[model samples]
Target: MSRYDWNDERHALGVATMDATHREFLELARAIESGPPAEFATRFEGLVEHTRAHFAAEEALMRETACPSLREHEADHARVLGDLGRFLQSVAKGRPAMARAYIASGLSEWFDLHVATMDAQLAAHLNARQHAG
Candidate 1:
C-alpha cells in the first residue's frame, strides 16, 4: 500500500469537513505517487490546488473560532504551500525527479505529523466549542 493511503485511525480527526478534506488530500497524493510519468505534472498541480483550498478552509475556521494556534498553523500551511510551489515549478520544467522524491517521502511524512499535531489540536478545539455551544 502507498504511504499516502489514509488510515482512519491515524488520520481522522472527527471533524467532518477536516476529515473529508484530509481524505481527499491523501487520495490526490496517492494518485500522484502512482500515476503515469506523463500525468505527473498535471496530477501534482491538482494536489497543490486542492491543498491550497484545504488550507484556506482550515484557516478560515481558525479565524472564525479564534483558535489560539492560528498563527502557528498558518505558518505551517505557508511553509508547505511554498514547498509545493517550488516542486510544481520543477515539475513544470520537466524535472520531476526531486518533486517525485518529495511526494514519495517528505510530503507523506509531513502529512502524518501535521494531521496528528496541528490538525488534531484544531479538531479538538472545534469539537469542544461545538459541544459547549
Candidate 2:
C-alpha cells in the first residue's frame, strides 16, 4: 500500500472536479513516497506538475464564481507551489532528502488541513452558487 492513500473522510469535497484533483494529488504523493529512489525525481516532478494544473483549475473556478476566499486560497497555493519548486530544485541537484521528508510528513499534513478548510469552503461556495443559479 502507498503511504498516502486518498481517504473519503479526509479528501472528498463533494465537488467532482475538486475531489478528482485532490485524489490525483494523493495518488501522486503516494507514488513519490513509495517508488524507488531512482524514480523519486520523476514522480515528484509529476506531482508538482499535477499540483500546478490542479491549483490553476480551482483558481479559475474561484474567479468564475467570485469566491470570497479566492485571494486566501490562491495565496496558500502559491506558497505551497513555491516550496515545491524549491524542493524540486534540490532534488534536481541530486539532493532529494528535503523533498522526501516533505512527501513523508509535511505534504500530507498540509493537504489534510488545506482540503478541510480552504478547499472545503470553496466547494461549498461553488455548490451554493450552482444551486442558486
Candidate 3:
C-alpha cells in the first residue's frame, strides 16, 4: 500500500498553481495521519472543504472551455465527494482507523485517477481557453 505524500509525482498536474494546490491537499492528508487528533480534525475538514472548492473551480473551467469530457469529469468529482463523505462520516463516529485506511487507499487511488484523466483533460482545456481568451 502506498502511503500518501507530495513526492509521488503522479499527483502533479504540470500546472504550477494546480500542482501546488494538489501538494497542499497531500500535506493535509499527511497531517491527518501524523498530527494530533484536533489538528487532524482541522486538516480533515480542510481536506473536504478544499476538495469541493477545487472541484467547483475545475468544473467551471471545463464548462467555460466546452470540454468534451465535462459531464464525465463532473461525474467523477461527485463520486469522489461521495466517497469522501463516507470517510468523513465514519471518522465523525470516532473511527479513525477506518478513516485513515480510506485516506491512505481510496483517497490516493481517486487522486491518481482524477489527476491522470479528469484533471489532466480539464487542465489542457483550460490552457486552450487561456490562449483563446
The sequence of per-residue lDDT tens digits that candidate 2 reaches over residues 1-133 is: 5547888888888999889888888888987777899999999999999999999999999999899999999999999999999999999999999999999899999989999999999999999988999
- Model-by-model lDDT, in order? 0.95, 0.92, 0.77
TM-score of each: 0.98, 0.97, 0.83
- TM value for model 2: 0.97
Tens digit of per-residue lDDT, candidate 1, span 33-130: 88898999999999999999999999999999999999999999999999999999998988999899999899999999999999999999999999
Give the Cα-based TM-score of candidate 3 against the true structure.
Answer: 0.83
Residues 67-120 of candidate 3: C-alpha lDDT, one tens digit per residue: 899998899889989878887887787776767777767788778778888788
Better of 1 and 2 by lDDT: 1
Candidate 2: C-alpha lDDT: 0.92
Which candidate would rank higher by TM-score, 2 or 3? 2
- TM-score head-to-head 1 vs 3, winner: 1
Q: What is the lDDT of residue 130 in candidate 1?
A: 98
